[model samples]
Target: WNVRKTSNKAIHGVYEGVTIFEAPAKIGLNQQAVGYVPTDEEWRFPNFGEDTAHGREFTQSREGTFGGDNGTKSVLPEHKVWFFYLQRICNHCTYPGCLAACPRKAIYKRQEDGIVLIDQSRCRGYKKCVEQCPYKKPMFRGTTRIS
Candidate 1:
């Protein structure tokens, strides 16, 4: 959402992180200090039909998908303001919610390695596990390659 130019809707400035502001949120667009949407998380330099590993579809997601927000909700500035920290992914969890949500009886933690896997043959992609998994780990891949 580089939005190199600004609009009245949601202005996603990249000067720092992807900072989205609602219609009411105002900023000087023509100013030299205009914000730039962070490219590290959301975009990758498209390699033009050459890099299969970095396909077009994959590059489309170079910018991380927006979640938990309704797209540029609102965040007013204040001298003594505090903002909610965004959630970032880390490997460990005390009570793994994903392992318990697989309905096919497919999910289990490895005794030796403590790893969990879903049996593709048994998975119906009903997304029951998607909804039930508290941690939101069971990603529902739309690609036929997975199912």
Candidate 2:
């Protein structure tokens, strides 16, 4: 999330600080990797890649099919094959379009922390916020009829 080139116009002049952290080693496909296991008390804290109340926050798509005309064999050399993944998340902009577009005023940003939140009680299932948001962060939940 580079703020300098972000699409959110409100934060165009704002400078956000970032701290880099080392990522966990990649695990082999279809195999679980050994790692830290939190206790019941510690489990209250959020863990990276854990399932959220909204289910998985991230979505993955296969860029393209690899391998063969024969259906199981690879025509390309093993050395030439490569894989890439791209992940997207909410930017939580200084001035969120979702907040402004919500006719019911369900979406709001906290002045103290600047975190944007939605009031499910106030939401009427109108998707104006979803239509206005450029980043596509405010997803509409059809099951609950809210955004």
Q: lDDT for every model?
A: 0.41, 0.52
Question: Where is model 1 more than 4 Å wrong at Cα?
Answer: 1-94, 145-147
Candidate 2 local lDDT, 43-128, one digit each (tens) = 22233235533233332225332333354422322222112111235687865667666678798777677778889899997777
- lDDT tens digits, residues 42-94, model 1? 21232222555434433232244322233432232222212211222423343
Q: Lowest lDDT 10-mer window, candidate 2?
A: 19-28
Q: Measured by TM-score, how close is model 1 to the native structure? A: 0.33
In model 2, which runs have C-alpha deviations exceeding 4 angstroms? 1-89
Scored by lDDT, model 1 comes in at: 0.41
The collision pairs in model 1 are 14-36, 14-37, 15-35, 15-36, 42-62, 42-63, 42-64, 43-62, 43-63
Question: Which residue pairs collide, candidate 2?
Answer: none
What TM-score do all the candidates reach, one by one? 0.33, 0.41
